[model samples]
Target: MQAVHTAATAPAPRFALRSSELPIGVVAEQLGLTLRAIRHYEEMGLIACGRGPKNVRTLGQSARARLAAIADLKALGLPISEIADLLGPDGACPDRLKARLRAQLEALDARRSAIAGYLSGL
Candidate 1:
């Protein structure tokens, strides 16, 4: 026998998240982070949230997207401080990022030269 599913019999989501919002747990799951990490991001002023029922933090979709970018930048080795500057309203991040890349390359070249000098002395 083929079982028919009814709307009333459907399982509800764990939270009553609205279309525009995502609960903090879900947001953290999406970003592959722990609740503590999500809260740290908020404390770092990199993202903002709203208080839901019982004062649980709820983040909107935009905030979630921003957090995703924060994750990506952090993965790319940018400290939270640098990520904040790149995400700031006044930031020209593409150009700023190019400059940062060039600086990193120069630093790496200097490190390489120092390593070569050390090896020559050995």
Candidate 2:
């Protein structure tokens, strides 16, 4: 007796991301960053951009991530050199990265506790 084979099912369709080709103003607004700050990051090589025929800057996904990272690191009071080192490709890690982040969190918590203690005593 011969056995029958079953047909395979088709995969589901993927939803495409809808992002506009944004200018600097639009990007600044979307990222909640100032135009001057974005320019400074670009100048520091933290963010990359493509230049149009008229030298208009166009940012890509990597640039967006770098910009966000820079903003976060700045808010955490990290120096630019340290942020650049942290964002470097060779510096990306599976173990060391987590350790570094934990250290930063601890430091932030300690600072917060100190501030709270001072406020409580005031």
Candidate 3:
């Protein structure tokens, strides 16, 4: 007797692996960060990347967003640790992250006022 395989029992289709085609160096350049800085962020658990067949790091859109956020937070003087806390697994910005950013901005404003006052006294 011959066995019959049903169409409903067919295996699922495989997806093409398009995510591994991104280049790490190009991402770094686009984000205005050094390749070493990108690796450092990965080491700090701030960004994630996939390994290519040859063991090269392949960053995706999420990594690009994280890099952009890191650069923005650094510009705002939030420090690396705080920026890492604000960024999520997929680079989604949480609402509470704004509180920390606001606090940092207040501190920067106070510092700027103090510098201005000192300059006026000279």
Q: TM-score: which candidate is best? A: 3
Q: After superposition, how far is residue 104 of candidate 1 from its true place, in Å?
A: 4.2
lDDT of every model, 2 decimals: 0.81, 0.70, 0.77
TM-score for all predictions? 0.63, 0.63, 0.72
Best by lDDT: 1
- For all candidates, what are the clash counts? 0, 0, 0
List the pairs of residues colliding in candidate 1.
none
lDDT of 3 by residue, 1-122 (tens): 97676899766545323643477777878778888988998899888877664677878776777788888888777788878777666666777687777877788899999999999999
The ten-residue window of minimal lDDT in model 1 covers 85-94
Model 2 ranges with Cα > 4 A deviation: 1-20, 90-97, 116-122
> Which parts of model 1 are misplaced by more than 4 Å?
1-16, 90-94, 101-122
Which residue pairs overlap in candidate 3's backbone? none
1 or 2, greater by TM-score: 1
Query: What would the C-alpha RMSD of candidate 3 be, to one decimal place?
Result: 8.4
